[model samples]
Target: MSGFQIGKDIISYVALGDSFTEGLDDPHPDGGNLPQGRYRGWADRFAEHLAGHVGELRYANLAVRGKLLRQIFTEQLPRAVELRPDLVTLCAGGNDILRPGSDPDTLAEAFEAGVDRLRGAGADVVVFTGFDTGFQPVMKHLRGKVATYNMHLRAIADRHGCSVVDLWSMKVLQDRRAWSADRLHLSSEGHRRLALRVCEVLGVPVEGDWSEPWPQVPPLPWREARQEDLQWARQHLVPWIHRRLTGRSSGDGIRPKRPDLEPLG
Candidate 1:
């Protein structure tokens, strides 16, 4: 994708997605989740990268954590189209795939519609395929569904003439350090790496290479690994299940960090 370009005088940009877009684990100040646009995920990072190449870029991130694909389409997509940005980046439908009986084909249909609308509005849209989840524990079971959806996403991108940041091919993300303790979201390093990847997709020059390998580290012993998995189950997995059971969402009252396109500094 080195030759692909959305970098042609992109004056405005909008990002739409869920937790990953929201920067869940990649806190701005390098700590826990903070409010008031502090979660500078890959979108923000990528916007900054663009700002370096262009001038006076207006950026908006209408991505709330835990948002379902349908919710994003009905809720954020309209606002994104309304923003009329020169560029748009979308990565949705992960939460839906996590559900018990979700269908990748159906989800892909909705996703393609959203892409079509954004493209129709004249924005240079960029879509991402979900990361290969085989590295995670229980979540790895959804690999087939994610893979299927990724193929759909690639097809949709081709059909719609949109750029694609294929996260499924980012083999570097398979490392444990790329993920946070919660095991659902990426760490700051992961977000940074993803930012560089998007820069590659858009043909924008950035300071770093995302594919650089991580430094060597000893592997955790079996007992310690097992303990960590148990802790994750107790901490992250259980709450997620409970929220689903109670019809609640992590982003229930959360609003988009940057609802309107604002000029970047």
Candidate 2:
């Protein structure tokens, strides 16, 4: 366990954002029982860790899949404020970064407003920057946009006295294993490691390391790799583009899994 500590006990935590916060692709046994397909993501895992430390933790996850920063700022922020949580984690703007013609500066401004409001309500806030996507075959083009957004997010975190989980520097996440089959959300193991990282950022005591290396595997043959890429584009990328063109979101009509701050299991 790391010696670093936040010192302040967190009794209530409210998470706000999109699919990453919503825990997409990290399926849990009981996930189907929750609202919005509710796969257990890093936020839920983080809450569980805190519960282990404090013996009681009230947690709420207001994130929904495919939400842009503006939607989160408008729909989730007010509810988070009403909860009056002791801790808040915001990880929005990712979907916005993926959209064509989206401006990172404008998104950052909206994000900062939410952070300031949460901090003003006396809650310790945590924010996450996007990961370095240079290694991803389909996502490399968006790397610059992600980097730009990360810079703005870091500045906002500093301005608001908020904790920052700098995913851009997390080398472990560069592994292909960290991503799901769709090449969008993190896999279950990836989500687990991310939870560990968040705990580390908060200075919370943790038993395991997120940086443990994955077992090595032989690289795919050139033909096989090309085939996989084609399949991914067909199964995931095309649908995503369709959604964008149709002005529809994957989160349409979906509700948060854990909308109310209730004791963590």
Candidate 3:
């Protein structure tokens, strides 16, 4: 990837991906309250930050809650091209890699092809590496796969001259507070920090710092932590597995929050 050069004027930007990009757990704040069904994920926050720098930016988010990589290819890619945005940010394949028997190599191959299409569309593309799963009891098992995929992502970015956000190297995300109760989606602070990271990678001037240290708090006792894990397993993990088994999706009836590029104001 050539990387996001400074002073690039991104008049229009679009984001493509799954639940992580959909901002599932992060409720967009309304005044002082956080209303349900309102999500402003990292991409949205980054869009706002970008608008502040570039001025009069139009942004659209095409990410759904449970899309696989192939679905993103078939669904989001064509629409993204049609938009002909000045910049495109894509963070997909996490859902695919979480499934059983999924092959990172095959996933990377398809991912590379998608990058090619976005670049070919004449948009400066940004891609993300999967976060380190080392913090999760279940996901820690997939560390090797995540690492392999991350390697491929860096290589792909290099080949295509794209800007890259390496989540695998973000130590701030390793903290439990950065995650929501579901232990799947990120919390509000997490999204904000990620937005800062995006600005840093893009060489854009943003208000906050992503590397700010987490507030020091006493760690949860082993008993409480395990209890939380069990609860998450029942509430989130089980439901996710059920969907996989039944071929259902959280995004089944849901539509993109921002289907068209709208002025950020």
- For all predicted structures, in order, the TM-scores are 0.94, 0.94, 0.94
Candidate 2 overall Cα lDDT vs. reference? 0.87
What range of 10 consecutive residues in model 2 has the weakest lDDT sum? 1-10
Clashing residue pairs found in predicted model 2: none
lDDT of 2 by residue, 1-265 (tens): 1122344454888999999998999987675665536689899899888887774688999999999888998999999999998888899998988878998888888888888899888788988999899998677999999998899999998887888898999999998899898989999999999999998888778999999999999999999989998998899999989998999999999998889999887
Q: After the best TM-score superposition of candidate 1, give how far the Cα of residue 163 lies from its true spot, in angstroms.
A: 0.8
Candidate 3 lDDT by residue in tens digits, 1-113 = 54344454548889999989988788876624533475988988888888877747889999998899999999999999999988899998999889989999999999999
Name the regions of candidate 1 deviating beyond 4 angstroms: 1-10, 30-37
TM-score of 3: 0.94
lDDT tens per residue, model 1, 120-170: 888888889998999887888999999999999999988888888989899
> How does model 1 score by TM-score?
0.94
Which clashing pairs does model 3 show?
Answer: 1-157, 1-158, 1-161, 1-162, 2-161
Candidate 2, residue 125: how far the Cα is off, in Å: 0.5
Model 2 ranges off by over 4 Å? 1-10, 32-36
